[model samples]
Target: MRLTSGVFMFLLLVLSSVCVAETYNMETQFIAPIKLPINLVPLVNEHLDSPFERYGCAASLRQSLEASFVRLSPTAEPSILVKPAESCLCGVHTCSFWILRQCGATYCFAGHLHAHSIEINQATLLNDYYGLTGLPGGATSSEATHFLFDGKSYVEEKIEPKQIK
Candidate 1:
């Protein structure tokens, strides 16, 4: 049977949306020594001109976390909190935030400045209770944006990190 383009598109969309794997929202604890990967790239907005530069911070953090996880256990699934902290900001230089991850339940930490890491009020889950998948928002191929999560999910949550300009 020949299906019209509009109908076919609608059906495909519905099926795809329905096929999304169900994720659990149950309260879970992080395994010991929650590791946060250190970002090796500069966090200046001007330096984010290329893909490598753009995703360097997040990708480096993920790679570091993965490496630590591999060393600890290749089979164990652990929850992680990736906190991006501003490390340096000068007159002309853009701000740079160092990324750190910890293993445990979410805890309140204060931001710092002057030769120290300032933890931002952002806690991103790395993996789930099961060793299956990482966080839902992966990097995208946008212009200069390194990481862009699902807009729909962010919209639903109504919480998007704002630039500290």
Candidate 2:
């Protein structure tokens, strides 16, 4: 009887852990761009070109950047979503956003977009990555652009028109 109870306890513990793991949801939470990881700095420098030269932002790249961590899948590594913070990195409506995913020891660009806001849809996925909706002018915007991973990168799938009240 003691052995049976022990086995039942072990099963209960394992089932509870599995349920917790399956219910984990990844949400985007934006935060101030802190000092980037040493491995990520070079990728940022390469992909995130000089905003000063392009948009004439007074602040340096690191200063104008905001960041968020998101895991595309329950089993996948978390990816960093870097976005513009200052006015210089944005247009009248939208700002640039980039996603970087770790590959082996280093990170690589997964996607890029210019949008007022972004939402990751876990229900939809392609190439083992979550689908992204880029709202160019906020939730009330007339249209939202959908992007899906194309094995190599995220590409625009369609422009969905939204009904405005």
Candidate 3:
């Protein structure tokens, strides 16, 4: 069967979305130790150019990463509230607020400032979650799920951490 270009594109998009495995709304408690350079503490909420700016963020992507966090997680599900905390890693330069998976890895999603859209790269996401020392990243569908749903199950509750602004 010969497929039209338009139809092919649609199929590809759908498949790409479907190809992403299903992650759980699972939760785990963590005690993330801060490891940031000095002077960047106050500017943790600033939109730095790159997340690796040695001193502080002077970039433009403040909200995109916020949206991506929701797309990344099942529980927090990346909304304005679930977005990366301003000063991550204890007021680091520009590291994102990540899911910190149980498998020991992370998913860093940073969108361009002003433009509130996310860019989810499969290779990058996979590498980060499965790579060596993937700093506090996850949300890719590799999480374990609950077999049955109960009213009082963990999924029915919310985990609200006292965030440091």
Query: In terms of TM-score, which candidate is strongest?
Result: 2
Clash counts per candidate, in order, are 4, 0, 16
Report the number of backbone clashes for model 3: 16
TM per model?
Answer: 0.17, 0.67, 0.21
Global Cα lDDT for candidate 1: 0.27
Residue range 1-165, candidate 3, lDDT tens digits: 356888999999998986664331112111232333233232334534444432333343332222212233233323221223234322222233333222213222222121111223233233222111112224432222111112111121123555799
Order of all candidates by TM-score, from best down to worst? 2, 3, 1
Q: Which runs of model 2 end up more than 4 angstroms from their true locations?
A: 1-34, 48-59, 138-142, 159-165
**How high is the CA lDDT of each candidate model?**
0.27, 0.66, 0.29
Q: How close is candidate 3 to the true structure, as a TM-score?
A: 0.21
Error of 3 at 132 (Å): 13
Candidate 3 local lDDT, residue 162: 54
Q: State the displacement of the C-alpha of residue 125, model 1, in Å, after optimal TM-score superposition.
A: 14
Clashes of 2: 0
Q: For model 1, how does the per-residue alpha-carbon lDDT over 1-165 read when each residue is reduced to its tens digit?
A: 356888999999998875554231111212333344333222222333345434443444333222112111223332233222211111122222222122244312111111111121122322211111212221431121122123111101233567798
RMSD of each: 17.2, 7.9, 16.5
What's model 3's lDDT at 18? 65
Regions of model 1 farther than 4 Å from truth:
1-76, 89-165
Instruction: Sort by lDDT, best first.
Output: 2, 3, 1
